[model samples]
Target: MGVHGTVAAGFEGVREEFSAFLTDEEHAPGAQLVVHQGGERVVDLWSEGVGGESLLGVFSSTKGAAYLVTALLVQDGFLDLDRTVASYWPDFAAEGKGGVTLRELLAHRAGVIGLDAGFTAEELADDRAIAARLAGQRPFWQPGRFFGYHAFVIGALVGEVVFRATGRTLQECYEERIRAPYGLDLWLGLPQSQEPRFLSTLPMLPTPEQAAEIEAAAASPYSLGGIAFNEHAPGNGELYDFPNSRAVRAGGQASAGGLGSARGLAGMYAAAAFGLNGRAPLLKPDTAAEFARIHSEGTDLVGGMPKAFGLGFQSYGAHFPVLGAGAFGHSGASGSLALADPRQGFAYAYTRRRYAFPGGAAPENTRLLGAVVRALT
Candidate 1:
């Protein structure tokens, strides 16, 4: 159960248990977890075929990074959450979405969840193409009424606003402002050079009974929008493997398909908590406060579960009860999670090459995290 590397400060057992649990076959094949507290790194650990320099697809956890980018734009007076999205991108008004505000979009309430028209993975790489499709798409529900968990669309919309404000894609803005300045290893649009370091995603394991239930649920109107009965049902899984998925990757959709190391992910959150390792703050104190404040708190339309969403990051109570409101962050499809408690300047980040079984978090993962929290308290 001994972690190979070092634990920064204030946390020791957390790092040890994290490494041990990751070694389990059911958890991350290769993963990293980094934690910081009191302006110092307390637990920086990695194992299970992952190393200090490894990078993994962080899934929805990418939302935190996207949220940071938008927050910066707001702080600089380039974007306003209260303003209509069309004010920035006129073409967006074409689809009866002229009334949507930046806040609704960020909070996953804008309702751009599903694209009626199909897109290839390659199409996602072309920013103009992706934005055009997104802009022309209609909302699944009325804007600002409730949350539907835009899943992938949140990133595209947020990216567009960031695009309009800076005259650069979200990828470019992140590199220029956030990643490069902090030396973060995260990438919205990964370069080809790093492909070797890319860990292949692990497959999900469902027992025959579990798979049957999942299939049934997917077919149910409550799950697949009744599309499960149609021959024309969209296959979202295909979009992940195909090279054409770059369009999805390139769009910087904050909800899914972002890449980074656990260290980099935790580093960004740690900056918000501890204020950037002796550098200028990543966000003003008030801005950081806004980032953690819940924009929408209720059951999600898609997941049909209670969720607490902030400006972009998912709040703690939505899933992990151990994560207090002060501990705000996001989790990927399976086990990937990135969070920081600004109150304590404690950040925890974990990423893996493999996808987790669908249902809840890996028990070993939670058990490890629980031990960490218990130790910290």
Candidate 2:
């Protein structure tokens, strides 16, 4: 299987790393990678089982898009970071959450990770439904005392705030202000016309040893990790199946329901940090820095792992040493990762059709990103 697409002259090493990655995999994990240096797309590549135009379920990498929209609204003064969330959506004030500020909510500190009564499949597919139920739920921890990864519901939570303030859904704002203007291939609410390009996400094919490790590390459905992912729900399907549903892609639940190609993901971030075409960057340096600054760092209460966050985006510098200090982005459960490194003057996106073993950002990103950084230097 040959790698497809072009790399600028000096970036051939990235293509070599990508091909090596495909060769090392036991199964062909249809993958796409894109990188932009300043305003120019320096790398655009895809491997077997997928095309350069193919769209895959990007899972939580979708969060980066949502966070970018929120950051823009804040930069425009339509939203306030320090103001209590209850000020925008009064219902969120119920159950001792009145004092939870927008900043705290974005940092995963409000503690209402999920409902004690888990969400139905339909509710999980709709951001409005998820927000409505969570509005009255009690926090899992004292609000502002601790932070947890609101894995499945943060997008809906932030979307609710966007709706209350602007009388528009975050998806709507994204399409109108970001996607359409930039002509980006990424879609919050994927339309019928673009359906043909989407490929269903495949489950992870782990080796026997890897399977045993996953089984051993599995937590109870009622555990914090389980609840955060809505695994406690009676009829809940696997996480990878979330974006496989047409309804999920159509609704664009905001948290993990995004569908896009690597080009779309990379382009969006590039437009945000370095501008695209002839336009000015979407975020001012001050606004971008504020949202990208580390707001939370340490063991996450829900996942019980060392995690870092800046507003809603994952602060990637700690996880990827090659990235600059304020680098920000989000990774999907299917091993997709996308972000813009303002300090490094580049935006990178990698998407996979099959879930990577050990999940999160995918181990291959470390080597692949290293190759990209070296080429840039």
Candidate 3:
């Protein structure tokens, strides 16, 4: 019934909002929330079902880290945004994808969302395997002509470029340059020592009405959305089960396999936009701006809904009105949301053990973010 952790004096409203939302929930959500104002921790709260140190799978929010790594490479001049992906990974040019640029691929414009034949569960857990399979697959649409949410494969596409350019995996780069240096809890490839802290993600418990609506809106496995999520695969399990598998957690599929708590999620963004733990900020202003600027807006070809995307992160400004322009971050399928708002001088993160109904960013984020902004003002 009570919330855990501390908030700065002025941020009591955020605690109140978090508690209010929990009180109304029929099920325990096992949630964690963390916020950083520049380099200072302002709010750190967790629900009864999850502790401040507990780690949960942060689905697509993993993409933010992947994107950040890519941004760093670009900032260092190791990678070029405008260069054709084929220029770096020659095999990527196969199947009429010779012209897909790194910029377009990061923007979800490459159209090679997933392999037509589908990936094995084992392959889905490995980014290199996923990349190899996708290399020969034809684009779902003409490259750069339209945009779709490359829900499951964007990381592999970008990671491939990173590997080709630097001779290291994205996870390796993230660990050496980002995670280990900051001692962040977020893990792209979680080590065995950290295994004890992980709390396996729970599936969504939708209300009867929500369940009925989902059933009504269900698309065929052959549909674009289905393929993007690899649901069309012959033996694919439910998307929620991906993180439960040890292989998936061990390999850290760049797309959605990150494991972390709210602290790690929030801290990673803080390190990117504002220096953390006395370290300098990871991203330069120009690099962050280029990655955060809206590159694709309007209907997503895969999701069949209005969406907005920056290089590899979601355009937070479009989805959360409280977030100012250029705010960038991403949400996970399990209701985890994390982002950095350089304009507002804060980085925020929220993670849940249980999936929320109508997934993506979870409904509670709006009120919670508004409360945080009000407290900041």
Candidate 4:
């Protein structure tokens, strides 16, 4: 490929290793992976195939953006985690969910996993309609019974909370308060003009030979692309590819769909690791602490593993070590991952077109990041 940027301060050897990782043809399509140490840009690297301006789909990594939205509302004193969802949106209590707390929803403990089968893609386009549908819908499991990853519903649930607390939708509020202020290129509902720039996510439908080849590889939900799996099948599902997808996209749903550039994503977390404008914190210290707190522990409904989750982001463990306990970020469908490690004062975002294991190509990426972190530390 052509010339990519270099690492800045504390991350010297990291950039060199990242450069070697980028050269892997299997890891290509392209990506931008950046790491910040002590609130300073240390490793800033972007490969050529993944241009700086290209907005590749970051899959579920969008959840990190969603977490930022909820955290901001909490910071502004508009939304309280301990408060019930019904406090902001009255209809949220229509069903047995009247008692579901914002924190429960944030931590993916909300029993409302999927919407009613009657729910349609058209309804997802209208925030009001979807919110109403969700408010009156019954829980997939008993509220607080246990945590199951609410894949698609997590976005609408969190976004609606932000909306009820603030007059603006998650997308609008995020842009004005977060992305715009930081000059980040991340977006939830990408506009039509920019849609062309978005690299549509390709399902990791392994070829017959590949599928059989990897049958014994592992049985991870993410490995099977479970949560990472897209249900764009013909049904009364949400309109994922609608021309007006931007409206729903504006909601900043963590799961279904969101868009942005790798660098832009790196920068957002970069701002989190560092401060935005001097003294202006993206999340209050307490809130940031909570952002990485694990609220639930059980077999993730989607990932089908013993996983833990904070308010919105996933942490490091058997599944991902690149994201340590102190780190908070999310992985998207395909092979996109983003996170912030306060312990190391580091943030990294990587995006690529290739969709490999749903459990993520983390093992491989971890090898790459381990080298990076070793250098930074």
Worst lDDT 10-window in candidate 2? 21-30
TM-score of each: 0.88, 0.99, 0.99, 0.84
Cα-lDDT of candidate 1: 0.69
Better of 2 and 4 by lDDT: 2
lDDT of each: 0.69, 0.93, 0.92, 0.67
Q: Per-residue lDDT of 16-96 in model 1, one digit per residue for the tens?
A: 577666545555356677766655667777775777787676777877888888888988889998999899999888667
Model 3: lowest-lDDT 10 consecutive positions: 21-30
Q: Native-vs-model 2 lDDT?
A: 0.93
lDDT of 3 by residue, 1-377 (tens): 77999999999999999888786453385799999999899999998888999989999999989999999999999999999999999999998999999999999999998888899998999999999999999999999999999999999989999999999999999999998998888999888998999998888877889889999999998899999999889989988888888898899889999999899999999999999999889999999999999999999999999999999999998888899999999999888899999999999999998877777888889988999999999
Angstrom error at residue 44, model 3? 0.5
lDDT winner, 1 or 2: 2
All-Cα superposition RMSD per candidate: 3.2, 0.8, 0.9, 4.0
Those runs of model 1 whose alpha carbons end farther than 4 Å from true positions after fitting are 1-3, 8-10, 19-24, 125-127, 220-254, 359-365
Q: 256-366, model 4: which lDDT tens digit per residue?
A: 467787667777887765675453557666777787887887687656678778888776543566546657788765577777777666777777765655434344567
At residue 321, give the lDDT of candidate 2.
96
Indicate the residue-level lDDT of 81 in model 3.
97
- Alpha carbon lDDT at 163, candidate 1: 84
